[model samples]
Target chain A: MPRPNLAPPDAAPLREALRGIRFLLRRGGATVADTLTLDALPDPAAGLAKRMIREVEGLARSVDEAASAAAKGVLGGHDNPAEKLDEIVGHSSAAAEFGRAIYTALDAVLRRIGVDDAFISEMSARAVFAAWRQDHPHGQPQDWAADLTLRLLAARVIRGAVPAGSGSIGRVEPVAVFAVLLWLQSDRSESENEAVLEAAADIALARATEIAATIGSGDQGRIAALYRKYVDHV
Target chain B: MSKVRLTPDGLPPTNEPLRVAVRRLRWFKAAFLKHAEEMGAELGSRFEVDDTKLAAAFTRWLDAIELQRPADKSQRRAFFEFAAALMMRELTVDMPLKAVGEPSRAQTGSAAAFWPEGYCCTLFCLSVHAAATAQEFHADTTIDPAIDDLRHWWSFKENTIRDASFSAGFLQMLLGSQPNWVMPDVFRAKPRG
Candidate 1:
C-alpha cells in the first residue's frame, strides 16, 4: 500500500501571518479594539505586531487621498484605484500622447461648458497634477499619465451619461475637448467622430442644458473620430 | 442562449473563486484547451485533466481516483487545471521540492491503490502561491505585506464608488477575513460541529 502524499496548507509568509493574527486576551480584560495592541502579544511578537499596525494605519491616509481625488473627480472611483488606473492607461500607444490628449479633451469640454482659463489652471494645480509633477521628474510618468487619462475618461463617460438612475459625483465633464479632437482628420474612418457628436448630444439631453457650441456637419466626423481615440486610450 | 446583457449590475455574484468560476465560461474551456494542448507536445503520463466537457471533467477525473460523492469536483479540478496550465511550462515532476505537513483526515481515506493527494497538494500550492504573489498595490514591484494594504484600498474604493447594490455590511463582512478565502472543495476538511 502506498502512502497518500498529504500536506497542510502553507502558512502565509511570517510577515503576512503576523499581519493576520489577532489574539483575544481576557487576562487584561481588553476588547476586540485592543486585540492588535502590542500589549496583547507576548514580547516576542510585539515588535512585529506594532509594525503591522502602523502599516495598516498608513492605508487610512491613502484612502483619504483617493476619496479626495474621487470627489475632485480624479481616478479614485474604483475598488482597485491604483490597479484600475494601470489597466486603463496600459492601452495607450504612448504616455506623452495619451497625457496630452486627455489634457486637451478636458480643456475643450470645460470651454464648451464656458469655464475660463483661471478655473482650468486652478484645476491643473490640484491632485492629479501634483501626482503628475511628482512622477514626471525623471521621465514618463506612465501611472500618472494613466491617472490623467482616467479623469477625462470618467468625464467623457459621465458626460455621455451613466445608466438611468446611476449618476457621477462630480461635473468633471471636459476641458481639452478640442485636444481630444486632434488627429481626428488624420486619415481614419470618416465617421470616427460620431461617438463624440452622439455623446455631446446625449450630455445635452441628459442635463437639459444647452451646450455653448453648435455642431457642424463637417466637424461631426472629426469629433467622433477623436472620441474613438478616447476608446483606444481608455 | 440569447445574448446576455453584461452590465455591471447584471453580473451575478457567486461564492466560487476565479478558478471555479472560469470553467463555466466557454472561453475558459477554449483557453485551457490551448494550455493543455501546448503541454501535450512532449509530455509522458502527466496528470492530464480530462477536459472532455467543461461541466463534468473534474467530477469524472476525481471519481476514477477517490470514488467519493461528486459534490464540487469541477471546482476542485478547475483549480488543478489552472495551476497545471500555469506550472506545466517550468514545473516538473519529482523535483526535490517536498510539500510540508501531513495529510488531514479528509485526505487519508485513499492512501493505497489510488492516492491522489500529491496531485491535489501541488495544485493547491501553485494556485495559492500564484494568488498571494500576484497582488497589486500602489507600488508595482514592491509589496508591503500587511492587512492594512487591503483596508486602505477597500476604504478608498468604498468611499468613491459607493456601490449601493449589495446589502449593508457586505463589503466589511467579506473584507474582515484576514486572508480573504474561497471555498474550493478539493480536500476540504470536515465542517466544525
Candidate 2:
C-alpha cells in the first residue's frame, strides 16, 4: 500500500489562521489575568475565577472571528479559506480543554480559600474589559507581575495583617517585589546593572517574605521582629 | 559689511579686513580686557606681557575668523566670543602666542608667513572655551557638588567644541587630548577622602 501524502493542498491560509489564534490567546490571557488580579474583588479567589472565565471567553470570541473571516474568504473565491476553516474547527476541542483547565484551577483556588461554591457565575468579557479600561484610563496594559505583587500587598493591608501605623512597608516595597520578579524572570544574558538590581531585590524579598509570614500568623510582635532586621536597608 | 577676498594661493591676507579688525577690537575690549584684569589680580607679577607676540596672535586669529566668514549675526557673535576666549587663554594660561608677519604679496609666499606652528594655541584656546561654557551651563551652584558628579559632567562635555574651527591643524591637535580643567564650586561638599 502507498503512503498517503501528509501535506495539505493549501497550507498558507491555515498557517495564517493559527498565527492569529496564537497571538490572540497570549495577549488576551495576559490582559484578562492582569485586569482581574488588580481589580478590587471581594476575595482573591473570586478575582482568579473571574480572570479564568474572561480568558476563555476572549479566546472563544477570537476563534469565532477567525471562522467568520475564513468563511467570507472562501465565498469570495480568495486564496483557499476552507483550509483555514478546517484548521480552526479542528482546534475547537483544544479550546474546550483549555476552558476546562481554567475551571479546574479556579475550583482548586476557591476550595483553598474555604469557598465551596459548586457553580461559579461567569462574568461577561465586556464587564471585565470595561473595569480594566476604567482602571487604566490611558489604555496601557498593566504590568502583570508588578500588579500582582501590589495586589498581594493591598490584600495584606485589607486583612489587617500588618499594623495600620507600623510604617514597616512603604512605597519602595512594591518596587522591591517588582525587581525580584524581574531578576528571577531574566535570562543568562543579563547585564551587571541588572544583576545589581536583582541582588537588591533579593535582599528586599527576604525582608518582605518574613513580614508576610509574620502577618499570616497574626503575630504583631513577630512582624515587628522581621521588619527590624532590615530597618536601614530601604 | 566689506566683501573680504582670500588670496589666490589660499594664504590669509597680509592685512586684516576692516570689518574683522573692528569686530576683533570690540571683542578685545569687551571680554579680553575684563578677563585680563582678573588674571592680573590673580597672578600679579607672574603674568608676563609679550605685546608684539600677542598682537601677532590676535591678527592670525582674526585672519582665521575672516577666512571662515560666519554666516549670520549669531555665528559672528560666536566667533567674536571665541576670539576673546583665545586671547584670555593666551594671556592667563601661558599659551605660546603665534608670531604674525607681513602678508606675502608674492604668489609664492615667504616661508615664515606660510604655515605658522601655533595651531596648538588655537586648539588649546577652543578647549578652554568649551570647558568654560560647559561650566557656565551645567555647573549647579545650588546643590552641594560631589567630585564624582563634577567628573561625570566634565567627561560628558570633553569633546564638545562650541564654535567652529576652519583649520584642520587645530582639530588634529585636539583629537585625542583631554584638558586638565577645573570649575570652582564654592558650595561643594567636602569629599569622603
Per TM-score, the best of the predicted structures is 2
User: All models: lDDT?
Assistant: 0.30, 0.33
How much TM-score does chain B earn in each model?
A: 0.24, 0.31
Candidate 2 wrong stretches, greater than 4 Å? A1-234, B1-34, B72-193
Note the chain A TM-score of all models in turn: 0.24, 0.20
i-RMS of candidate 1: 18.7
Q: How well does candidate 1 score on lDDT at residue B63?
A: 30
Candidate 1 lDDT (Cα, whole model)? 0.30
lDDT of 2 by residue, A113-193 (tens): 233332221121113223433464231112332333343344331111121243334433333333332332222222232
Kindly report which residue pairs in candidate 2 clash with one another: none
Q: After superposition, how far is residue B139 of candidate 2 from its true place, in Å?
A: 16
**DockQ of each model against the real complex?**
0.01, 0.01
